[model samples]
Target: MSPTCELADLVLPSTHWTERDYLADEVCSEWVFGQQKAVEPLYERKSDVWFWRTFGHRLSPEWWPWESDEELFDWQLEQTHAGVTWDELKEKWIHHVPMMPSRDFEENGFGTPTGRAELYSVIELVSGSKPFPEATEPKESVYATPDVAKAYPLTGVTGRRYPIYYHSAFRGIPHLREIVPEPQVVFHTSLAEELGIERDEWVWIESPTGRITMRARPSDGIDPRVCVIPHGWWQACPALGLPGYPDGSSNANTLTSDRAYNDEFLTPGLRSTLCRIVKKKEGE
Candidate 1:
């Protein structure tokens, strides 16, 4: 269970990887991995396939004809790759597909309205945007919003990953929590000195949108004007005497804004957000 699950009114027990059979593939790789189940589902828990198939059957029996995960896997394999079977996958555990020859763009041209790897897109022009690519400053940054930048001078990058935990996961695990006890605002030594913050000391990282408190972790590798704060810090490790950090307390998204985004994809400006660090006083 996770922080999201903790807040859920109705929780359904799902099978762990050890209790489920599945297929996994590495990105951009020709290899496919068959994940064999090591153990059966304990208690009232069931595999996601079971849960979905059960609900799907009640909704529409015609579409959810597969009675077992193996049947579904067979159909998936047939659709994705020919000459591959479930039994062979279970026995081998891994299969390497032969890579296809690269398409000759020079001979056949690219896949577009105006092929040949168009630098100026006809589709974009038709959509009333620049035909060619144009790089611009983010709408909520030090460069674009100078007036707001005065209060928030540092560039705050959110969701810095830790080896021990995935985004907002495994924090409740004692061993992992011991490895990374608390979330820290990682910045340059110069910035730490300027703000009179020491290593492992609590500090407030305030942006124009919002603010969050985290332990200060100064490093020489990062830029003085930039700070990296990790996300997913809600779960508590009772063994470490660490309480769960409330949503607005340490979650990086609390300091981010959804008001402005990229012109092309509408990705919220998380990395380019402006912020400032201040050392936390006693009892605060």
Candidate 2:
């Protein structure tokens, strides 16, 4: 069980990807792939649409009339007005939108108040932002706060994602865990050498908020003044005999603070925070 699931009062068993029919979209890609259901959902497990439809029927049957996923998918395709059908998608399993190498703005004009491409936005100005974009330094970065940087010299980069898993998912899978056994603090080889940290050795990455321990992994590609840590890591793989790192242990979020955030969006300054790396003592 995951840390989140452990905290929850009740957990519902949902149908896995292989047990559902769905469409997948890749970022910035023109191709849409159709996935067919491999097997019926196991006991007590239901697809997302099933849950929604069940609730909808109880609440308002008139609003949610589609009986099954096939009906819902058919209605969705009909709204596209492209004459694409569920049977066609299921047969081919892929559809590609032909991209024309021409700007739509030339034919239909830009979608703005002035109907033109704008370097300075009037909408942003009305919404209490500067007309032109400004590049400001991160609130907790080494360059922004020199005094804080003196104590925490290295730049900390968090939320490094790997291809084996999406964010913190698939960690409980034995095969995936075999590839990435535990969390790691990735830094430059030169930085690790200077700190007297050995490869695969435990090290503490400390920031103003908190500190977390991760295995040292020195890489030549990383900047000497920067260290990267992964996030979303609260799952355990029992088959591999690996213990799950609890919250605030190897979790990179422990080192970040919500105090410093983007002025416009209020996004926390976790990416470029200042931190120091130190070698952990044996059995400490």
Which segments of candidate 2 are over 4 A away from where they belong? 25-30, 97-117
Number of the top TM-score candidate: 1
Q: Identify the candidate with maximal lDDT.
A: 1
Find the 10 residues in a row with the least total lDDT in model 2. Answer: 23-32
Candidate 2 lDDT by residue in tens digits, 14-58: 899889888664734465567888998889888887788778977
**lDDT for every model?**
0.84, 0.83
Which lDDT tens digits does candidate 1 get at residues 13-111? 988989999876674557767898898889998988888988998899999998888888888777656357777888899888666767788788889
Please give the distance, in angstroms, between residue 272's alpha carbon in candidate 1 and its true position after superposition.
Answer: 3.7
